[model samples]
Target: MTTGSTYTLQEINALSHDDFVQALSPLFEGPPWIVAETWSSRPFRSLDYLHASLCAVMYAAPLEQQVALIRSHPDLVGRAALAGTLSPSSTHEQSAAGLDRLSDEEIAAFSRYNQAYRERFGFPFVICARENKKESILAGFEQRLHNSPGQEIMLALGEVAKICLLRLRDLIRS
Candidate 1:
């Protein structure tokens, strides 16, 4: 996708499958396979349709694939964020949620929570950072850590869908 550029629905609808995948690859943290697989469902009727199609691909995948997708996400305020290795969308989302301005104690708390969550769930805690402030995110970690593995996976996947929807809105005009 072009940096700082937005696409009209008409333009998006007219793109080739390869081009569509390229445009949407950044919607998820890991592989672009979700968008790649969803490409066949286009031309989307609306922005919502496009997002639903992408989420459908994600949700319809086997449990192993779904877990892999969750594994692909980086922890909040974890090593990747501290090291400046996060993807552009991730960086922006985290920054918007005030994650970039955390105090040392706050960072350590996040690190601890992230470690605990991963130890319990075997995947990074996923949330729509663009939709939560630092406080809420920490609270989410606390509350969600108590969830059963099955519950947590579905919750994380729903968060992934929220993240993807926001990213799609940022990229495509309805």
Candidate 2:
């Protein structure tokens, strides 16, 4: 087990079975099972391996599970953010992109677009918020709306992977 502001790669690679899951569970927004599943493939040689292992678990998951994972993520500037109840990571990422400072018109636009995207895809719009600005997120929502459901599913999962990688990088020491 390791506990600190950051843990070295070696330290993480050496964690006990349960400790490993506890350390990495927050990397994904959805299933807590992802980390436990990933922990079985221990001795990750690098951060990339750690990320790839997680993605593999998600990819190997059932279709319903993958969709559940997608659905697990809150909408950008959605109810959680509005109620000041977003997870710490989400709050920070969203605030960094000015999501927390939206104007009334902007909030309305986001709310409307989020609803439309959900109606079309059956899941919330997802983007790596830390890697994007407010404008790009809105633009992406519009663009992705045109994609087929299959394409959107793949893209959304890929976005989730990117989010997990960024969060994992934060958790692991450089």
Which one wins on TM-score? 1
lDDT of 2 by residue, 56-161 (tens): 9998999889999999999999999999998788888898889999899999999999999999989999899999999999999889999998898899999999
TM-score of each: 0.96, 0.95
User: After TM-score superposition, what is the CA distance of residue 36 in candidate 1 from its true location, in Å?
Assistant: 0.6
- In terms of TM-score, how similar is model 1 to the real structure? 0.96
Tell me the spans in candidate 1 whose CA falls farther than 4 Å from its real position.
none
lDDT leader: 1
Determine which window of 10 residues in candidate 1 has minimal summed lDDT: 1-10
lDDT of 1 by residue, 1-174 (tens): 225668998888888988888888898978888988998887888999888999999999999999999999988998999999988888889999999999999999999999999999899999999899999999999999889999999999999999998888889875
